[model samples]
Target: MPLGDSITGSPGCWRALLWQKLQKAGVNNTHFVGTLPAQGCGFTYDGANEGHGGYLATGIVSNNQLPGWLNQTHPDIVMMHLGTNDVWNNISPDKITTAFSTLIDQMRVSKSTMRILVAQIIPMAPSNCADCGNRVIALNKAIAAWAPTKNTTSSPITVVDCWTGFSATSDTIDGVHPNNSGNTKMANSWYQPLVDNIEALS
Candidate 1:
């Protein structure tokens, strides 16, 4: 499922672009499943996702929501791009990582073999929130370090760097949220990981 915050839920959200790209590439049997129906993206896709706009990592985990979603959807793979809101809210990176770990564990509890693609959230524009951008960088580093330890004999968590080439000034609408170009970049970033893990679905 396309899972995250507003980046995955917004109308022109990257999830739609990713879905559309995958469809065009012949991965037509896949479906985006989530408790929340897809909004925005102009009806371009099935619009199913777990992206809760403005949701914080702690809130998502504290509410114990992932387990229910995992049980209901039973998705073969989960694409996660969270923590933006947490950083925006000035939450500590350690807490953010803990929440993310909890989320991953919850998903594994539901399906041990499930594949998860965790994103290094995109850069924040200086005009919007400069300090948050640095936080995003540090968070991404922490997430990268966190992924290897998460690899299991069955499920392996892969980290996709959505921030490396993402230029906030050019690719975002409001520094944090991605625009069409940014979404396209995200879609491309997810392509290989999706392809590499597509076998999990089969």
Candidate 2:
């Protein structure tokens, strides 16, 4: 299961590329989940998407509702591609990490066996927003540092370095959201780690 904003949304986005890779890798009945046109962090469709385009991690998971995506899907593996919007919103890394930890904790209760893959949110082109690029890097670092110490929960953390996997050098649809080719590359980032290991990933 993939949870996120546009970076995780498919049907025409990069998610398609990742899906194609997962298919080739023998993942069956797997697909990307999201809501479109930017809803600004509402837990519609049972947590499938809180796709408000400008939302940060704090807004994505709130007290008002349980994330339906985790409850319904209860996915064994989850890819998180959020944080860019957090940059746009000027949120701090500590705050973002707290929100992620909260959401992961929630997911643990929803699906105790799930392995959560926390993507170091992709690096945008210099034009995307300086704040976002910096914040994303920080969030990724924080995730890397945090994933190991939290042994109480069942959700393991894995970081797919999307900034290195997909970047402006390989992007489509301008420097922001990746196009088809870029998506495939980004999805490819999941292959090696997913195949060889399943422990608390980083």
Candidate 3:
């Protein structure tokens, strides 16, 4: 399950491109559910184009809905790249951190061995939100700096560095979401690392 906000839910964004690449790479027939549809996403809903989007890392965790959603899927891996919307909402970083920690706690699910790769959200530029700059870098830095070194509730919480590759070219569609080309680049950013580390995990 890839959990997060508009970036994850966007129709033509990286995740969607990643799905296509996975299919092309022969990882097919997997089920994907984007629950953040009510907020207006440029996504396919029952084969319809809809734009439902908006989310905050803290808000998402506080809801208790993500746990239920995760359980419904029984996911082997959780790819989480979130928190931009929280900045947009003007939520304090501390609260965002707590929400994410709680979300991780909920996903741990009694230590059943689920690998969580929290992709550090990259910098988004030329946006109106005061915090939209490399605020993502700071948030991601917090996760990157802390989660992996310390033990997480989940077995191994790896932080994928989306900030590295996508940072310079991070802005694409509307400077908010990555356009198709940028999305492909984002998928490439993730693929090799995942393949390298996938075999090492339990």
Residue 49 error for model 2, in Å? 7.2
lDDT of 1 at 43: 50
Worst 10 residues of 3 by lDDT: 43-52
Across 1-202, the per-residue lDDT of candidate 3 in tens digits comes to 6677667666535665565566677655444444433222255322111123576777666666676676555666667777778766666666777777777777777236766777777667744765567576677767766675545453677777777766434447666677666677777776655554455552
Cα lDDT tens digits for candidate 1, 1-202: 8788888886536777778887888988788888788676665687788888889988999999889888888987898989989988888878988998898899888888878999888998546566887888888988988888777868889898888888988999888788889988988998888878886667
Better of 2 and 3 by TM-score: 3
Model 2 per-residue lDDT tens digits across residues 43-90: 222224333444557876764233655555556666677777776667
Question: What's each prediction's TM-score?
Answer: 0.93, 0.76, 0.77
How many clashes (backbone N, Cα, C below 3 Å) per candidate? 3, 5, 7
**Using lDDT as the measure, what is the rank order of every candidate, best first?**
1, 3, 2
By TM-score, the best candidate is: 1
Task: List all candidate RMSDs to the true structure.
Answer: 1.6, 5.9, 4.4
Q: Which residue pairs in model 2 clash with each other?
A: 40-52, 46-68, 46-69, 47-68, 158-201
Off by over 4 Å in 1: 126-128
Residue 75 in candidate 3, Cα distance off native in Å: 0.7
TM-score of 3: 0.77
